[model samples]
Each structure stands twice: as C-alpha cells, then as structure tokens.
Target: MAEIDHIVLGARSLEEGAAFVERHLGIRPRPGGQHLGFGTHNMLLGLGRGVYLEVIAPDPAQPDPPRARPFDLDDPALRQALEAEPRLIAWVARTPVLEAVIARLGHRGGEVVAMTRGDLSWRMAFPPQRQDMDNLIPALIQWQGEGASSRLPDSHARLLQLEGEHPEVDAVRAALAERGLEEALKLRPGPHARLVARLRRADGVEVALASG
Candidate 1:
C-alpha cells in the first residue's frame, strides 16, 4: 500500500517559507539540502511517524535550471500567488513498486526522474504536464534506502489529517484509490483545487495548513 511521505509548502524564498512555519507552527524547520539539477532547496519539519513537511523555494545561489522547475515554481502566476503567502503546493506518496503502480494508474503519474540531495536520493514520478488532475494528484516517490523521514527531528507537531478539495472530488478519489491512497486521503468537492492538512502541536493547539 502507498503512504504519504511528505507535504510541500512553496514560497518565493526559503527565508520567507521558513518564517511562515515558525510564525504559524511555533517551530523552525531544519535545513534541507539543495536539488542540484532542479535549482531548488528546502527546509524540513518532521510531522511524526514517517510523514514530514517540506518548505521549498528556488535557490538564488544556483543558476537557472535547464528545464522548468518542479511544482510549477517557474510559472509566473504561481510565483505571484506565492508572493502573498506560503501555501501547500504539493504532496508525495511513497510506493515500493513504483512502476507497477504507474502502470496500474494508466500513466497519470509521469516518467520517473532520479533526484538527489546530498547523500539522499529517490525516484520521483511527477504527473503528466505537471498540472493534470487539477494538481490534486500526488507525485509518487520510491526512496533508495531508509528515506529522510527517519533522520529528521520531531517538530512536536502531529499530523491529524490530510485532505483534498477539488471540483471533481469523485475522480480524484478514484485516482487515489487506484494508487491505494484513497484511505489515506479524503477528497471533498470545492470550487478550486487545494490541499488541507490539520496538525496538532505539543501544547494542544491544532492548526490547519491549507492551500488557498
């Protein structure tokens, strides 16, 4: 069965992204390394169990990527949207048999791309055109080893739920079911595409992180 590996929060800059987490969750995220080819870097916050939160932004120190950056970071509209606030942009699901799952889903997930960050590496399957399925669909990942979640420090935040909002909730649910993730995520009909995650802090405060 597939499981959620991480949730992605996108920002115009890493500084801005980290600040958003600190301001809302009352915790700072640990530094994560850069994606060399992708020209991006991230900060990580462990959300208990094997799930984590990733704050990602383009690395100003790096040259422009050869192709468009992942998660539509290069898109002007998305960049403008992120200027207002850091938002939940994407999520990843881990599967051992990535190829079989891709085949089973009839190729909704794109070709597998090998990605590395320092000593960590994984195979990621992005969706076709990168925006199909209203961006409600999750990218698929196959970790090379134990994965980064095990090495992260606990951020004292417990992920209570992760859900999706879309106009076509039934179709999204069916796709998740095909990937064996229907039980892991709940989809509800809404006017737009969005991700909503509820996290409980150590002090008994619950916060909802939503893409808006």
Candidate 2:
C-alpha cells in the first residue's frame, strides 16, 4: 500500500517561501537542490519520520525548461496566485510498485517520468498537463533507495493529518481507494477542491496549512 510522503508548497520565490514557513512554523527550511530539466528549485523542512514539506519555485538560474514546469509553476494562474503567498499545492505518495500503481490508476495515474536532484534519483507519475484533481490527487513517487526525508534535517514538526474537500468527493474517494490511498487523507464534499495538512510543532501547537 502507498503512504503519505511529502507535501508541496508553491511559492513565487524560495526566499519568500522560507520566510513564510518560518513565520508560521517557526523554522526555516534548508536548501534542496534544483531540478535540472524541470527548471525549478526547492527548500525542504522535515516533518518527522519519513515525511517532509517541499517549497518549490521556479529556478531563475536555469533557462526555461523544455517542458512546462512541474506543479504548474509555469501556469499563469498559479504564478499569479503565488504572487500573493505560498500555498499547500499538492502532496506525493511513495510506494515500491510504482508501475503497478500507475497501471491501476490508468489515466488518473499520469505518465511516469524519471528525474534527479543532485545525486538523488527517482521516478514520478505526474500529470501530463496541470496538476489533476485541483492538485488533490497525490503524485506517485518511487525513490531509488531511501527517500529525501531521510537526508533532511529534522524541523521539530510532524504532520498529524491530511484532509481534502472536493465537489466530486465520492469519485475522488473511489480513485484513492483503488490506489490503496483511502487512509491517507480525510476527505469530504465541498463547493470546490482544497487540501489541508495538520501539523504539530515542537512547542506542541497544532497548525494547519490549507490550499487557498
């Protein structure tokens, strides 16, 4: 069965992202190397165990990517939204049998692509276009060995729960169940799609990062 891996936060810039995290979570994220071909870079904050948060932004250091940037960073709508503040855009699920999971999800699974960041390598199942399900459906990842969280510095924060609301809640529930992800998120029906992650800080305060 697949498990919650990492959550993605979209930002206009890495500096802005780090500041936002520090303001809310009271800890700054550490630099995570750039995705060479994806034309993006990130900072990571450990969420205890093998889960973490990834703040991703366009890499001005690189030329435009051959393809559209991941997490819809190139989408004008998303870019405009990020101009205001970072958002909890999406999450990823890790599993050993990525190909099998992809086959199970069919079109919803997206195309499998191999990618690298520094010496770490992995394969991911990403949507061909913009993030699907309003970025509610977790992207699937298969790391070569240990995942990125292992190498990340502990931030004294731990993810406590993940929740989502969407117009088509039943369909979304069925899709997740097919991928053995039904237990990964607490889902409900809403006027639109949105994700929420609940976390416990070192000071024992519970905070929420919501997609808005």
Q: Top model by lDDT, which number? A: 2
Candidate 2 residue 64 C-alpha distance from true site, Å: 0.8
**Candidate achieving the largest TM-score:** 2
Global lDDT of each candidate: 0.87, 0.89
Model 1 vs. true fold: TM: 0.96
Clash pairs detected, candidate 2: none
Q: Model 2, range 155-175, lDDT digits (tens) per residue? A: 889899999999988877887
Q: After superposition, how far is residue 132 of candidate 1 from its true place, in Å?
A: 3.7
CA RMSD, predictions in order:
1.3, 1.3
Worst window of 10 by summed lDDT in candidate 2: 127-136
Give the per-residue lDDT of model 1 (tens digit) for 1-212.
Answer: 79999999999999999999998889989999899989899999998879999999999989999978988888898899998999888888999999888777666768788999999999988887644565678889999998889999888788898988888888888878888888877878988888888888767899988878
